[model samples]
Target: MTLLTPPGVYTPQADTALLAEALRDEAVPPGAQVLDVGTGTGALALAAARRGARVTAVDISWLAVLTARLNARLAGLPVRVVRGNLLAPVAGQAYDLILSNPPYVPARAATPPRHGAARAWDAGHDGRLFVRRICREAPRLLRPGGVLLLVHSALSGPEASLRELRSAGLKAAVAARGFIPFGPVLRARRAWLDAQGLIEETETTEELVVIRAERPV
Candidate 1:
């Protein structure tokens, strides 16, 4: 479970732990194809591989890719770590399960940072940039009966995710939820969040949700 997260690579935090817990609740048969998008340290990917799945981990950051590769190697897990935008590196690939803990924090910037550690969590204004994209693309990459388990802040609009996935012809719903105290990132943006009505004033906890979507057989 320990991973090497360098300066710019995202560290495994509460979201990672929650997603791993959700992964455990799924039945991943041996050699099932699994994709972990935005894999920072290959934590989720390795978790799936440990369940006897063939996992591929993808990240947009070079540091993240290298860190994930090293973690996989160190863990002796057979995870193929690649550096590319979400799902792009694995195009044309179909997976029985897809996992992601993407950037979902609403930020002041008009767009996500092109570089830096913030790229791991500083989503655009509404914080649904990556979430929406995943909802749109996951259905196509999933095999019939395939499942996608995605985790993000409740502040990012879970209803929108469910709606989008349903619109794409998948059965989607929140499978798990948890509350965690604000981390440094969220703590720093508390003022903005309150101003935007994303959170109540003086609120210190945020709800995280694991959205599970299945491609109907």
Candidate 2:
């Protein structure tokens, strides 16, 4: 689906597409309450809405929030678009599903960008900043039997995510996987990644993993 991704707003790409495919495979029934954390153009939120799930999309960027709200209005789909840090806007709410394609690329910076386009992709030195936070909060945000479908780079340590989710009392596993050639972001950071021993010197592609964690009934 086409979306209005203005400058500064993240455009849905491989990670978003991968997570959307994983969402489809889950076959969420109508009326399920779905929360989309770090929604960019509201692509995944709209995808869930199209499947008849009630969707609320959250983003930290004002441009992203506006773009997503506009896109949803244009599509005639109802989505509660809010601007805030991940999951904070929806505190005290529980969802049948929580979806996220947050910033996971390891960056030279010690912390993620507070503003600008890079905020959409650059995580801290070891990445996993948002990934780790989500794993910690997902248990509190999900309803019994609810699932969280999180997509991130293999370089971010999928095992760590699984371990965190499991430790939170949820059943977690890598639900899907795919590989994509380095994008400009990864390509630019290739040297740092190599020096940090996160990727092979000649590695041309990065594996993306979709982790599915469920709160037991």
Question: Where is model 2 more than 4 Å wrong at Cα?
Answer: none
Q: What is the Cα-based lDDT of residue 71 in candidate 2?
A: 99
Over 78-189, each residue of candidate 1 has an lDDT whose tens digit, in order, gives 8999888898888889999999999999999979999887898988999999998999988899999999999999999999999999999999999999999998888888
lDDT of each: 0.92, 0.94
> Relative to the unseen true structure, what is the C-alpha lDDT of residue 129 in candidate 1, on a scale of 0 to 100?
90
Per-residue lDDT of 174 in model 2 = 94
The count of residue-pair clashes in candidate 2 stands at 0
Stretches of candidate 1 above 4 Å error?
none
Each model's TM-score? 0.98, 0.98
- Model 1 CA lDDT for position 142: 99
Per-residue error at 171 for model 2, in Å? 0.7
